[model samples]
Target: MKFSAERATLLKALAHIQSVAEKRNTIPILANVLIHAADGQLSLKATDMEIEVVEVIPATIKREGATTAPAAVLYEIVRKLPDNVLVELDQADGDTPLQLRADRYATRLNVLSVDDFPSMGAGELPCRFKLNAGVLRSLIDRTRFAISTEETRYYLNGIFFHAADADGVPLLRAVATDGHRLARVETDLPEGAAEMPGVIIPRKTVAELRKLIDEAPEEIEVALSETRVQFTAGSIMLTSKLIDGTFPEYDRVIPRNNNRILRVGKKDFSDAVARVAAISQERSRPVKLTLEPGLLTLSASSPEQGVAKEELDDNRISYDAESLEIGFQARYLNDITDQVEKEVEFAFSDSAAPTIVRDVDSPSALYVLMPMRV
Candidate 1:
């Protein structure tokens, strides 16, 4: 089989697909990328079993054939070739060794048998729909920071996505938490999404797919099966297996009937938290917030370092009692507010109960921070 293609086109396809190939794998085939040349299009596919990506590009195919070669090496070689140089790929005797050439740069890369490559087969996707790429990007961007990295509680390691009520109507929701902080965001439920099962997409898969979706076209087609989900956008496709575990029912954990409410500028809260957290020790980095009437005071102290307090002027704290003090991981609070587009509303009952924060007019997204003992 032989194919000739512009260096830039081949490099782009390889770059798109090679990111999904595992750098080091126990099985060598997992590190190899499958190259298929047919018609006037060329396809490069790679997978790490859990996540797979395939990129398609237009090429001049003189002979139709498929072969597997080291994904990293091929990507690096093509990246170094001249921009418009044409690359030609062919097999010497249709055997295990493949010939690769592009002008002065040529190499014979050892090929893995195509029979050993594992391709995921679609299993009758019960639920499918179209999601706007921009909306999907917003959901991921605003909440990914709160996803748990603790492997022990694997159930909380990804965004918990489901259908829920938003202002008494049906809506699609995504929630992520790491015990200390929680991020919840929602969008109008798209048609045909009510019956879909809630899936916990792993963090690694989410990050990899994020890059693909960033450059994807405006609309993306999503198909979800019992165990896996596939996104087809433009000339690329990504398939990933959902994490197999029960996501914690976080509804009960969210406090209800909180009486204290404080409305303040999102920027002010974030900056105050950031400055106070700087002096906090690494291990128990807690910032104490004192709310009383119209005053909001942030303070933090470390055993080796003295206490520091910063007063925020002209804020709205609807409490008149002795200051209601709440301690929290300053970084968590800052992360939740950093994405806020406008003012923030902080809800609380007492210092011990969890506090919920949200944009003034947008209830679609909510953030919860569990209080820490300072």
Candidate 2:
């Protein structure tokens, strides 16, 4: 393959592609990126079996050919090259090393057989839709923090995406949970997405997708099947295999009739929780909340570190519920509250039952936290 591409453009594309390639792989080809040059464009592709990313950029093509080279090495070389300098890549055949040249720097990267690079064939994607980049970012940012890191319950290790009806209105929803806490966010369903099947987008895919969309254009094209999903953002295309497992019926865990409503300033509550939690040395980092008419008290205790407490009065909080004390992991509380802006509403059932939380400003998003015994 032979092509010349601008250093800045090539480096940006390589940054996205190399992240998908595994640094250490039993199959050597899996650690390399497939570089194809043809038709006035250069296509770079990398995959780690479960996820694949491809980026195309305008390049001066001298010959139409393809080869595989170390993805990390290529990215580093181009990234360190002088800015705005044109980068030239050339290879005579699959057996020869790929030559990389800039203004004054040159290096040869060992090439692998392009035929050995695996492709994650996107079978038939029946459901397709277009979502605004801002909306997609909102969906991921609000819920991904709750995605499970536990390996045994693979089903809970991703965000569950599906179409649902909220009061006869079709809505696209994203839900994630790690057993201790759950986050659910929804938006108006996009066109052509009403019949899409429920799918669990793996954590890694969500993370990579989030990074790409940060610089993506205003709109993103999404296509999905029962087993796979693909996202297209301008010249970058990402295809990932859906986690083959059934997510639990999450609605059953959401408390509906909590009735005891407590509203507090987001900053005040978060800061108090952080301060009190600093005293607890356990992994759970338990923080206890004591609630009463017009007042809320936050406290945490450790046998070795002593105890800490903070109080928010009616001025900063509004609570008319009868006396109630609830225990929760401080980190989990912060994670849910971080998504809220201005004020946070807490609906409590009892100290023993799950507590419902929401952003007073956004009705489309809801959270449930399982109380930790303090």
Candidate 3:
């Protein structure tokens, strides 16, 4: 196989696909990326069994053939090559190593037969839809932080994506939770996605998709089936097997009648929480929020480190309760506030009930945090 490609173009494609290949592999072929040169294009593929990424870039093909080489090594070689130079890859015989040549560099990398590469299965998708890249990016960003890292409750390890009705209006929603906290974001349903099945997009797949759509690609084509989900944008396609599990009914946990509403500046609340929690126990990092008619105070204490406290402007906050004190992990408070750009509304029933947090202006995104016992 022989082909030539521009240094910058080739490097970008290789850099993105190589990340899918694991460095230490029980199976040798898993460490190599499949390179196929044909039809005036070079296709690079890398997979770690669960997720696969395929990228195609325009290249000059002198011979149509395929081979596999160490993904990381090839990427480094292409990245270090002089910009704008043409990189040539040649393999004259089936038993010969792949030859790479740049302006002043030349080397042969051991190659594995392309037939050894794992096959990516993308079943026929009954639901295919097109969504604006910006919209999809927003949905993922809002909920990804709450995805569970726990391995036992595998269902919560990724974002739960499905179609739901919000106030009689159909909307596409992404929900994630780790028991202690939950995040839910919703957007208008894309055309042709009415029947899309609920799917748990694995954490790794969500991360890869985030990278691909970060540049704000104009539109993304999404195809979904019972077992897998595929996304295509520009010259790249990512396919992954969905987690086979049922997500709990999270709506039941979202507080609906917690009317003790308190509005506070997001930055103020976040900073206060961080300061008070500085003296909190290492294990829990617990911060207590004490709310009253016209004052809100945050405090934390550790037997060995003493205690810390902070008081915010009562004018910016409002609460209907006579008085209530709730405890939460300081890190969780920071995470929920980091996603908000303006004021935050905290709705609580009592010190022992789950507190609901929301951006005052963004009704589409909501966070539910269970109180930590102090």
Candidate 4:
């Protein structure tokens, strides 16, 4: 479309939307970004069929028109241009190729008919509410790391968002897990989200939204149905279909009465896990947790290598019951504790039962990790 926009603004918008377009496409038009202009505003849209991103920017719409061009090439060229340059798109010379002009630098990119681009389905979006950017960021960062990359369990491939009863009070929760470990974090239910159905946000969208949250948009408008979900923040909007499958019932696996408690400094625990787990095999880095009256012991060993034992002071570590030795994938334990902001508490039912780690203050955020038989 014929429009003029700030070089930096154009570059940012292009970078955001173009990521949704896959590098290699089975269809030619799938690699091109659809450009639309009207009312002095330009919109850039790119889709890989499953996900679609639309970015709008303020521009001088000299002529209202629509066209498509390679998303990657245009993004790179615009990104490399001089700072503060005003980019102008012109199609008035009776040439189908749109001329990108910025000061002395210019390029004529062959444009395709916008009609061939896939049309994004914008359903009747009603449910929406504003949540703090800080809250959204917290929900994603804490849980996204545990999302499964395994293609077999497609249902666990994204973070689960839904309303649930936490501490006997209504709350909105986000959960993600592979088979080894799981993260469950919840926040107070936002207004207009009381009846929102649970949806599994795809992994790609989880990552993309993390980048956009830096804008600190006022309202994170969310809309979802049984099959699809959409999020609108700042001048960008993302839409994607929900994963069509049933997520495993994770609550039953959460150890409810894990009475054995050990309070340890998060940083110290993470460091010990990192050092000891290195010597163990990648597949079975089962770091054993041995709790005594006043000490917390972390030990690991391998047949190929020797063994290691680290004793740390945990003032509250009092386990009168039989000495419990719970084994866990040290890396998984580290992932759950690395992002935690403060003191970390590990609770266990037994050496064989599931072990849970939680913040000493934040009851809403909990991690359930399966134990290994060492």
Candidate of highest TM-score: 2
Backbone atom clashes (below 3 Å) for every candidate: 0, 0, 0, 0
The local lDDT score (0 to 100) that residue 148 gets in candidate 2 is: 92
Give the backbone clash total of model 2. 0
Candidate 4 or 1, higher lDDT:
4
- Point out where model 2 deviates above 4 Å: none
Off by over 4 Å in 3: 280-283
Where is the poorest 10-residue window by lDDT in model 4? 314-323
Report the lDDT of model 3 for residue 187: 93
Q: Write the per-residue lDDT of candidate 2 for residues 287-317, one digit (tens) a residue.
A: 9999999999999999898999999999999
List clashing residue pairs in candidate 3. Answer: none
lDDT over C-alpha atoms for residue 215 of model 1: 83
- Considering summed lDDT, which 10 consecutive residues are worst modelled in model 1? 314-323
Q: What is the per-residue lDDT of model 1 for residues 1-374, given as tens digits with 9 covering 90 to 100?
A: 78888888788788878888988878899899998889789888999998999888998888898999999999998898887888999885446588889998888999988889998765688898888999888888878999998999998888877778756888888888888878888998888888888988889878987888878999888889768888898999888888898988788778888768888888777877877787856846889989887788999987777788988766433445455888988877888888787788888888889999888877778888899986
Model 2 C-alpha lDDT versus the unseen true structure: 0.94
Candidate 4, superposed: residue stretches over 4 Å from native: 93-95, 280-284, 314-322
Q: Give the better candidate number (1 or 3) by TM-score.
A: 3
Ranking by lDDT: 2, 3, 4, 1
